[model samples]
Target: MTAWLSVIGIGEDGLDGLSSAARTLLGQAELIIGGERHLAMVPDDGRERLCWPRPLKAAIPEILARRGRRVAVLATGDPMCYGVGARLSRVVSADEMTIIPALSAFSLAAARMAWSLPDIETVTLHGRPAEMIIPCLYPGARILALTADGGTPGTVARILCEQGYPDSRMSVVEQMGGPAERRIDGIARDWPDGRAAELNTLAVECIAAPGTVAHPRLPGLPDDVFLHDGQLTKREVRAATLALLAPLPAQRLWDVGAGAGSIAIEWLRSHPNNKAVAIERAPERCALIARNAAALGAPLLEVVEGSAPQALAGLGAPDAVFIGGGIGAEGLVDTCWRALPPGGRLVANVVTVEGEKTVFECHQRLGGSLTRIAVCRGEAVGPYTGWKPLMPVTQWAAVKP
Candidate 1:
């Protein structure tokens, strides 16, 4: 198919920065589409122009309607890098469009800060939760974030101070590659006010205060860190369970009967692309799961408050499923097993004898491995440290063939 859509990555420099081929396409285009700021950059050229509507997805149909027409789209930097072009590509194939590239915000910010792009983490806070960056906040880490507006810098600064990285350096580079370009720099504790422009990128150098709590991005987070009513999975068993589940990038997990949402939260923490849904029957536990997810830097964790096997309906199929609670619940395991695609994984942990019996039967029928997990911690026993054993856990793990 002949390409009719030309997606150009324009910078703050606007027309001056556009390549000759990009300029030619814009001149030939019968319709131009872009945000208000981007649309204002192009002078009245007698071509039809459309500013993006609220909820950008609403414009998809209009773009599709003009699929075969000469339509030009203006986007910031690289359209594939958290830009409208990426979203459009999902509905429009590569053969139907031409993409012209420009320097991304990450590249421009990295150049200004003298920071290496590969070494630092890059995230977009535009139209996303500020807490989404929490996972990237660690001592000695570097991050470049694309802001939604002027207030995002202060919001991120407050989060840094609250997370014990008060001394972290914050630099907001505004209007990059343009005449109005300027930058504001300070520590998170004393972030300068009213300096960030609406269009800007924030750079941070994480520096933790002494005695700050370190939350590593590992599966076995300390059980004490989570708020639970003794229904939480022990740290050791959680590690073993996660090892069996084997989370891969971009894979989705369904944590049935999630208690404290430990497995689901840790799965999200393992990789940014990883997603999870915590299905719990209790409303109070569902609320606790949300709290734990936010605190653990996995705010994207979806909490489904209802009994599983019924609540599982309408949810997108998962790459892996973990049943931590309700192991003995009738039809729960069968429903989850049926939901799995070929090569999909299922791992269930149980501590009760009845639950273990259910797991044993499933192991026999499903042809998977069953293992016992046990852990003991030292505790004070009459002024002497003695081993206090935790309840042993029986785990069943299988992959749908």
Candidate 2:
């Protein structure tokens, strides 16, 4: 006999988001887990309310040990999206849990803006760094971003301003799907002066000059857009790497040695609602990545401007990862591989002989796909009489088993 855990998604409007069945489940549960706001939303009956203190990971196992007890965990929006349900599921089997999903804030914000969600890219910054969204931004792309807090809107505006999109139109939707909902509209160059809602989302419309970079498919962006200092993958090579990684909707990507952030940016561009975190040590490079993402329309790109493998700490697990620059670092490949789930994918790109050997060794140990790529272009060498070979790229792609 086992206890059942009910994970419920509530909205800013409180109990109104719950379905009749969900409400019944909450009423019957003896032990309830939630934040103060969610706890206050439930009808104050005799049901024992447990406040979730900091360090939720430590508390899960202890609470689950109490077998045969009914439990209900509360969360905002869909618990599965950037919420607590996934974390709980890591420890508890799916058979022991029931999830009741409500309208996600991203969806609500899109509706309020009178925009079709399928057509707009959406990213979440809640409980994540702003740098995570950098690679997704593209020129003329519309985006719906779930901000971490009130300060997020200003941060987004500042980032967009730093990029070339100073005139980009932005709409901030606050307290979405609730009675107190409000919407504010402005340009990135001149964000309106007002306190933003703690619970809010942003809508950005990218303005790009014609005949620059071609628009890519929803999830896979062309590699020509990013500004890199010879550390980035060419457009053709980047597309190949992303194809092997196979990013899905809502999955998070951990991009190491982000370099101009080609792989990370493409992951977000592949799916409107996808997420990623790009890690880079160079401050100037990090700033460049941020500008590239915002200009492209991924205002949610989170840039972790610190050196790895030290900077890799504190980041939660990712669905997939791409290692572009740090393959030769000691234990870097092993650390990333260990962090992945059984089905998680890791793709690394290399050019130098040392990098190739490192990736090959990792492939033999980890078991995945290996390939070499050679690209050449015909430069105008005295009226286009000769072909110049671009540097070859060695790619090793693998899935954790």
lDDT per model vs. reference: 0.92, 0.80
Q: Which stretches of candidate 1 lie over 4 Å from their true place?
A: 192-195
- List the candidate 2 regions with Cα displacement exceeding 4 Å: 1-3, 43-47, 193-195, 209-375, 382-386, 391-401
**Which is the leading candidate under lDDT?**
1
Candidate 1: tens digits of C-alpha lDDT, residues 1-401: 89999999999999999999999999999999999989999998688998999988898899899978999999999999999889989999999999998899999999999999999988888987777788888889999999999999999998898889999999999999999999998999998766478999999999999988878887898998788978899998999899989999999999999989999999998988899999999999999999989877888999999987889998888999999988777798999989889989999998899999999999999989999988899999998999999999998999999
Clash number for candidate 1: 0
lDDT score, candidate 1, position 244:
86
Per-candidate TM equals 0.97, 0.67
Name the lDDT of candidate 1.
0.92
Please report, as a residue range, the 10-residue window in candidate 2 with the lowest summed lDDT. 209-218
